[model samples]
Target: MTDFPFLGILTLLPLVGAIVVALIPRRNGELAKTIAFVWSLAVLVLTIVMWVAFKVGGDRFQFHESYAWIPSWDARFTFAADGIALVMLMLIAVLTPVVILASWHDVESSPDGAKRSVPTYFALLLAFEFTMIGVFAAADVFLFYAFFEVMLIPMYFIIGSFGGPRRQYAAVKFFLYSLVGGLFMLASVIGLWVVGGHTFDFAKLVESVNSIDQNTARWLFLGFFVAFAVKAPFFPFHTWLPDAGGAAPAGAAALLVGVMDKVGTFGILRYCLPLFPEASRWFAPAALVLAVIGIIYAALLAVGQNDLKRLVSYTSIAHFGFIGIGIFAFTTQAGTGAVLYMVNHGLATGLLFIVVGMYVARRKSSLVSDFGGAGKLTPVLAGVLLFAGLASLALPGTAPFVSEFLVLIGTFSVHKAYAVIATAGIILAAAYALWLVQRTTQGTLNPALEEIPAMRKDITLREKVVVAPLILLLILLGFYPKPVIDVINPAVQATMQDVGKTDPGPTSVVANGGAR
Candidate 1:
């Protein structure tokens, strides 16, 4: 472990930036925005350096740093990065700047249609980024819980204060669902202390908790599982996603779905399985069933949606189901694919939200019916939207395709039935994505929209700049994911070993009846 507190600095830099932005006079909105963007970019640069320095195939938690916060309770402000956390941290760092640029003109307005204070808006974004980094980097269980709960506050305000017309309802709903989940997790956190000695350090908990009886461990696991499932918003608990996504500002929605919800899956991989291995295995079947159902059901719902933002949100729910399947499958390849899926999903869905936001900005509506022949008016924007949509559907030559393929291949090795059923989501994904393009860009121009000056214009240079990096990443990762896969595979293998599982041997045979 290094003595340098790189992880702590990475976690706090955004918070410090938020403070500075907040202190800036509200009258200087542009200055505040500039400062916040620069700070977020600096955070990205630091994260890139951290990535370069990370020692792959070494200690599970690199750049470890710890300082006792409550000695009696064994609580500490500890932080580190494994391959999974590093990937998520990179996602947060990359998306924060892209979101900042995407929201350059996404001003909040009063009921009378006057623009409100933009400084507070950007400040909240920075604060949200702070909690996001903390959640991924925290090594102590209590620290993780604190960051987890604190993250909801900024997102709640972002949605309720700056979102669409039903912002309050959506925000409150999002808050309540998340609060209930967090409360369930709090109970589990307390239970861990009581059952596994009073240590809140994740490493200590994992070392000590094996003595817990099966029934007790299962209950504890359920407590954490419910919270994660709700956050994952799997199946029955997923009603909040569409409402929240549809109502939030595009940047906020992107982070909400793209980066923040990932904590749920990350928690399951990081805390749930290692700490409650037997219980995780015991519940695997039930979890897999829900994951499959979510995959099929959400995809069907997405196909029926006419609202563009809500459609995109539904697609996310379905994709998360694929991630859930990968995680629970207990194969190293599946686990690596799940983690990779988190990164790719962020890029593809973030681009989709950005493109949709551009359309909404021009048309002032997200209804699919409100658009027509937009491809003719803005060919570059249309092409980007099509590419993003292809990525969302896991088309060949896209980042998602590689990840999704690995997930299915890995799952098929263990549970062929589940893998087969989950594949339906891909076809449904194609349906919804192509339908979106057809309705919004292929038909004759909507007469109502044709009269609008903004609707007639092409994508702006700023929008192109904001989207270009994500496009490049999707293509780059699609072709050469070895760099990420190499880092991920070792961590995933370790996780599977901890869970007492291993991938089954390939069963296919050659024509001569020899193993291939």
Candidate 2:
């Protein structure tokens, strides 16, 4: 674990790049963008290298590094990558480059006919990437909380500066909701330190705090859960997502929904369950109820959205519901599926946002009514959109299908009614997905766009380069998920053990169709 400080390098590389890009003259937008892309690409390469060096099926956290920051308080600059963190790290590394590509020109010019400085835009992006890596890598609770809250800073600027007409409103709404959530998590973090003899080390906190009274533990669990649920933006707390997504630039929206928002679910799996086992069991039923409601409500709302970006955002809310259920269901398969869902959703939804950006770039609008027979005009772009949308719906042979299936089957094994109701989300997903495709691609061309040659042009080479990998990966993981599941299962099994539960054995059926 001490062989090299790979995690530190992975995080700081982006931070340094952001600083470098920021220092470059504002007029050198192209130069700033190039440096940002190169740095992001380098980070991606290093991440791949880290993945190669990572020893799967071994220690729970590899590439471990820790340094005392405040010896008196037991807070440390700790970092590591478990299977879950590794997957998220990979998602961030992969998406950052894609986002750099997609936003290359979009951020240089605004929708209101104003030119915006590109350097600041890309700089914030890199900064956002740094915090994302830190959030996934931080092993200490204090470090995690710091990274978690710091992430909102760059995102707030990205939306407020580079986003749509209501950018300020959206950005402030996002910031306030996230800040409130962070406050709750902060309280919980302090509570852990007080209860655990003044240590912020995650393992130590878990060992010490578990012995605290049940009532105090439950309060701590609620503090963390409320924060996570808001970040996951589950059900009632999810109103901020559509506003943020609808207002932010496509690239920012992708990272927001894809990688950063996932910190919520990750925190639950990493902290809530293991550190507060009895409290988790006490709250699982209620959490499951909210999860199921989020699934149905978000999907229905997605169906009614006319704006493309808002529609996509609602789907994300729905997808998070699936992930939430998986986490709370307490089965190995379900937990594994939840982690896998995080990765797959990043790919599918990120691609969707990129595609929508392409559409908005050409058509100058995101309303469903603004596009008609787009497939006839831009077959490649339309095809990619449909592919991503299908993946979003969890169609068979797409990446989401595998994870969604595992979640459902595993949930059914434990809580049959929640699983049954959650299945309806799949139906709603298909309706919205197909509706999106039909309205944008299958209908007659809108007369307003008939004479616009740019509207007819297919996606560019750069666009293809950005989206092709995501599409291929969705298909690849859909067919073969063993590599991911192998890494995730061990950690999930350990988590279940900590929570004092195991997957129930499958029942065998007799030839006469009776269960043995």
Candidate 3:
């Protein structure tokens, strides 16, 4: 077995960095920023090394590490990475540094009228990174849940403390929603422990769950599913997302709506499906139906949005609805597409928030109307926004295009009507996306905006540094995604095997071929 200590070190690195950064003197803002950057970069390098060493060929969890943390309850400080987790780990690694740089200009030593320490904000942001990585890497269910729940503490502070005017309301609302959902998931986790012979090991739990009574399994599954659905912010459970998104600082919002939301869908794929196959199958259609409804309903809502950030948030909800349906569709293409969509959405959405934050910094507004004729004022910023928007709407040459196409093709195979409904979301996406671009970037210059300052100094060098990799990948992945799809296919195959059937069909081949 590969050394577990290395895994432990990887997990703890960011947390340690956070603590160190927090302790840095307040007057040493430059020092604090430098430390944070170095810490984030160090963690990224460590994660990359871990990735290089990770054995993707085997379907079993790799980089296995465990330590007794709660013997009575059978909990352990366990962590590992499967292909799915590995992808998430990589995404986290890439995004952390980018986000740090994105916030470099904004998270100042003293940003005039800011309450409760700028240093604290950076520290909390760093801490959140640690938890996010832990959630993706944890091999033990309880450990996973702990990391997952821990994420909210920092994110709440980030939004409520560092965010906009309604930050307090939005933060409290986000925390409450997440707390209730997490409690439901805790019940499910406890149930899984009891039902699985008091084992907290994820692999063992899955095996034990396969033999449980279907009725009991359904309840357990719902417990987990409801929590994830809320995190995924699906349909009726998604009321808090726009508010949270609108209120959060750009960097925090990127992490929340971009990366954290994936945890929900990931939990469904990793735990819910393989562990509760019968329930998953039994409920797949219902979930698909709800997902379709979310897509259509949220897309319609997006069209009417005046707030740019909120509108983008609604679009994410719509995109996630597609992801939910894709996962539950139980087709390889759909599942793989969903996985790719997770990463693609993170990059695209994070870029969207970053760009909008810059625009707001200059224009002093998030309203779509306030942004009229920005293309004339800031050509480069407008161009970047257009690029980010195209990726959002799944333009054929962009990242979302391939993933969404695969999702639809996969879903259509299993449920035609649901696919058709979800397809309409594409039309709505196009409308809102193009309309947003036109109103913000293509129209005549609004006289009021002329006095607002020239597009935040035309996207700083640091900003360019932050977004460059994401943009390059968006272009690269749109045409080629074999690296990710290759890793995902084996895992998806393993999952499908556990679910009781296998098919080497058209969609399966395409998914194996990677985002074609």
Query: What overall lDDT goes with each candidate model?
Result: 0.92, 0.92, 0.85
TM-scores, all models, native as reference = 0.98, 0.98, 0.95
lDDT of 3 by residue, 89-205 (tens): 788878877887788766552234554565677788789889988998888889988987999899998988888878899999999999999999999999888888888898888
> Per-residue lDDT for 53-79 in model 2, tens only?
877778887888998798988999999
Residue-wise lDDT of candidate 1 within 1-516, one digit each (tens)?
255678999999999999999899978988998999999999999998888888888888898999879899898999988999998999999999999999998875743496777888999999999999999999999999999999999999998888888889999999999999999999999999999889998988889867998999999999999999889778878999999999999988999999998999999999999999999999999999999999999999998888899999999999999999999999988899999999999999999999999999888888998898888888889999999999999998999999999999999989999999999899999999999998998879778877889988888988988999999999999999999888788888888988999889767889998985
Clashes of 2: 0
Model 3 lDDT-worst window of ten: 107-116
lDDT for 180 in candidate 3 is 97
Q: Where is model 2 poorest over a 10-residue stretch in terms of lDDT?
A: 203-212
* Candidate 1 segments exceeding 4 Å error: 108-112, 508-516
RMSD (Å) per prediction: 1.5, 1.3, 3.8
